[model samples]
Target chain A: MPILIKDRSMVTPREAIAEGDFSIGSNVYRREKKVVSQVIGLVTIKDNFVSVVPLKGKYLPRVGDLVIGKVTDVSLSTWIVDIASPYPGVMRTSTSLARRFDPIKDKTRKIFDVGEVIVAKVFSFDRTRDPMLTVRSDNRGGGNSPYLGKLVGGRVIDVSPSKIPRLIGRRGSMISTIKHYTNCKMIVGQNGRVWFKGNNFEDELLVLRAIQKIDREAHTTGLTDRIKNFLEEAKKNMPTPSKEKQSDKEKRSEKKS
Target chain B: MAKNKEETVLITKDGIRHDGRKREDLREISFDVGVLDRADGSCLIQWGRNKILAAVYGPRELHPKHMQMPGQAYIRCEYRMATFSVPDRKSPAPKRREKEISKLLGEALNPALFTYLYPRSVIDVFIEVLQADGGTRCAAITAASLALADAGIPMRDLVTGVAAGNLSDKIVLDLDDVEDKEGLGDLPIAYLPNLEKVVLLQSDGIFTPDQYKEALDMLVPACKKIYQLQRKAITDKYSQINEAVQKDIEAEEKDKPAKDKKKAEDSKAKDDKKAKKADDGKKSKASDKEEKKKKGLKKSSKKKDDKKQASKEKEAKKD
Candidate 1:
């Protein structure tokens, strides 16, 4: 018979848990009649399934994940990109470039030189091979994906990949708020790399602070509202561009009159 | 040298050792989990005077493709003692003893891990002994296991290590530097406390069959005790994180109500201003009645504020 343990907050390794528990996640295994926790974590039961939510872990790559990668090596047809994972991400010249080119005649290095940062999607990956990345979607009808291709003149900051969801928030709410407040365009990668591009250095710094705050406090609830309030406070303290523009308009009108 | 020889009486007649610990008494052990931010998992262990730091990286792509295993992940372990770790300054080079301990620790840890989950990958366990007071290998194994767990590596069970030695013809548990140097036999054992199995057992010096059996008997229970401390350390770190999450949730909930109250108060104040203007002809009479009502409202609001403050204090105390 399987014993049902309910409302237990934490579990240590080798602790006998219930069988038929559906939510069992990493560091948990099923035995003859019992499930065992393999690492120390909080046990959460949802919809009658038990899963252990780990407090810390390394990033494991998955297909269809958007990642920020730095070009490490440029070969004849492929570029070896470091996606901050154990396995290097490979981008073929055929899939990454918008225009077709012959690898025999054209130098792949000209298209993507070493040390260039590119935001791409994980097209395919398997345990046996390195992850293949694509700069744009294969669907021709989708046109150019705005976020795809090489990132230029922006600072890339890293946070724990697990906290990326919190930074993005539900339906991109947190990220949108940061963009609106700082007037900065931001790209968040699933591999914990974030690209920040703003009008000035100060705005980029503000966005960086917000991203770091979210990473540090990702486990907490109401993070979206907290980030919203933080951005609002930061905006209030900054000198307003609108005020300067208004003064300029008044001075022009006075001169015209 | 004469003083050292005179003090070589490691055990008293009642079976107490030089450190004043009775037979079967382990050292004071403590664990600090996730000590390094960059590593996947890391831990610092303080076992008596021995301080060991263990860091784990990977389940990552293994280099030198030839060494990659198709069916299971490779567990690589490196054990190093700092030059200043021992009383005498040791050389920085990897010596024979370090290599042997590293290989054995890797082998001992592999059985507990679910390596099949990450094929063609490697998990590296790096152990650095900052201070050595004997039983460094056992302490390193203990810290490495915690670091692995901290890294969120799946395992069948946690490994705990302890040493039992024959001092002055008596089997004593957790031999210190002095006892180790003076003892006749030292048995270091790494065990799966929950599984009731030994993964690594090494004996230095000589022991009779009965003496070896007695040492085994002492070592297992001591390992189990250390296992409890390891579990406590991991849980304590996570529980503290859980509390912070809960507090943030509570604060967010509190903020919503306070904002709503502020909006309600603003609208009510506007309504009072309109009422006072409309009743301008009977101003004196209306003002007295309004003052009394305002006092009553203030008293009630004060009471509500007190209740909210009390609840917050209770929550803080609980945390």
Candidate 2:
């Protein structure tokens, strides 16, 4: 009765009615009542259920969800992808695997090449930890099989996979604020995977610093303002392109139209 | 009413009674009527700390009038307390105390009512005490009176009750249970403020004739104030009648269009029925005349379907 909208990277519950042109992850029914899940995308119709194929990878994590994964050999095709839990993600191609890819692809390099991390879903069993995971639908880039994005590293902290939306804020505005100022290539993994790449090595450290600040002050007000100040101070090393060029580009487009 | 062997005064030179009441002050009494919708009539009364809700049902067709006296209607009164009404919870049902109070209360008010106006009719009064600090019986009487009036039963006058008890030996107006048990004397009286008569009277302990006169005299003003409240309750109930009548009027307005639509359909159907009857007559006469002409020509389309059926049967037998 609930479907994750790939575009917004948010879940739309069954009670909400969509306005127009939305995609349904599956044929949903409860006591003969149909529920509309997503607004638009390629939905894999398997059996009676379906899941949307996201045009972009935008997986927002919930507080406690289960994910599955595989171990790639030592970060070549070698990184192991984790489906659930906070630590031991894609085991840096160094840890153990629940399973492996096809043999034609070399165990170490073919299946998951250097920097290749796949998607996985969580299936937590114990009360204290997350479900250790496996792949979901193939249409989801074959579920969390590492598709494309940076294996962003930082001093990782755990958050309720649930609180991710509130953290993202309205229209990704909060995260966007962090991105605009930090200038960090931030990739949020579908299965609670969040990675950050700085313009420079210093920029990466600065991004980690800001992320650490957010983790400490997530429950406060005026977070965007605080993040802006933090980024403005960090931007001394790497500033942005001049606004004059952006304005001129806008004017040229207006004239062309 | 008689005073006990020991007597003391409630107020001192400071000019305040033991319960902080002024010398001539009446106890606080508040009432609301028609609080329940399903009941024919209902009221809630708060006389100081005691609280009661009374529901009245009746003047309807009586199932059995055998209990009625000759030339008079029967009256039923039930006074019960909720399990949580007192400091300690009570049994689920109204027990011995409730039974006695119901009987005593029914008798206390019976003389004032003119139940003989309608024969084979029963008036049921059910009173429930929610919080019984004291004077619950008196509260039940006042609430029942309002409920009866709310039911639109014709009454001589509204009965207003005020219990004047000796608290610390100074005759106080309405005592809480503690004071009632501890006081030297107690007098519970219900009177008709308009008729100027005591419809109910009960006295505990002994008091001088002068003291009795003083207690009764105190009730005069106290009961008058209570009468005003009961009148307001009845008026409020009548104001709600305005809305009930308005709802019926709206229903009638809605019903008019439905009735008109049905009538229009009936008239239109009458015309259609006449047309159909004429068409049937013409068709019957036309068919009789055309039968001879049709018999002259034979149709051949049915022959192919019938021949196919016969060939298929022959093929099946050969197989």
Best prediction by lDDT: 1
Clashes of each: 2, 53
Residues B177-286, candidate 2, lDDT per residue (tens digit)? 76677777889888877558887788887677877888888878988887777766655554455456456446645865785686576556555545675564443333
Name the DockQ score for candidate 2. Answer: 0.00
Tens-digit lDDT string for candidate 1 (A1-257): 45456645678778776776454565677875577887665566666566775555656679999999899998889999989886789999877777787967899888779999989999898777788998866666777554787899989998877678878889889999999989898999999899989987778889999997787677666788888887875764554444456779999999999
CAPRI verdict (incorrect, acceptable, medium, high) for model 1: acceptable
Candidate 1: true interface contacts recovered: 0.66
lDDT of 2 by residue, A1-257 (tens): 33333332222112122333334343221212433322111234443444433211112223334332334335443354544322333332222244544445646554445444444444333322223343322343545443332233443333323335434666777678777866676644434345666655666777677665554444345666666665764563232333335678999999999
Which lDDT values do the candidates have, in the order given? Answer: 0.84, 0.58
Chain B TM-score for all candidates, comma-separated: 0.82, 0.69
Error of 2 at A114 (Å): 88
Candidate 2 deviant stretches above 4 angstroms = A1-257, B1-15, B61-65, B92-96, B240-319
Model 1 chain A lowest lDDT segment of ten: A235-244
Give candidate 1's error at residue A251 in angstroms: 24
Q: Which stretches of candidate 1 lie over 4 Å from their true place?
A: A1-8, A20-27, A140-146, A241-257, B2-7, B244-319
Q: What is the interface RMSD of candidate 1, in Å?
A: 8.1
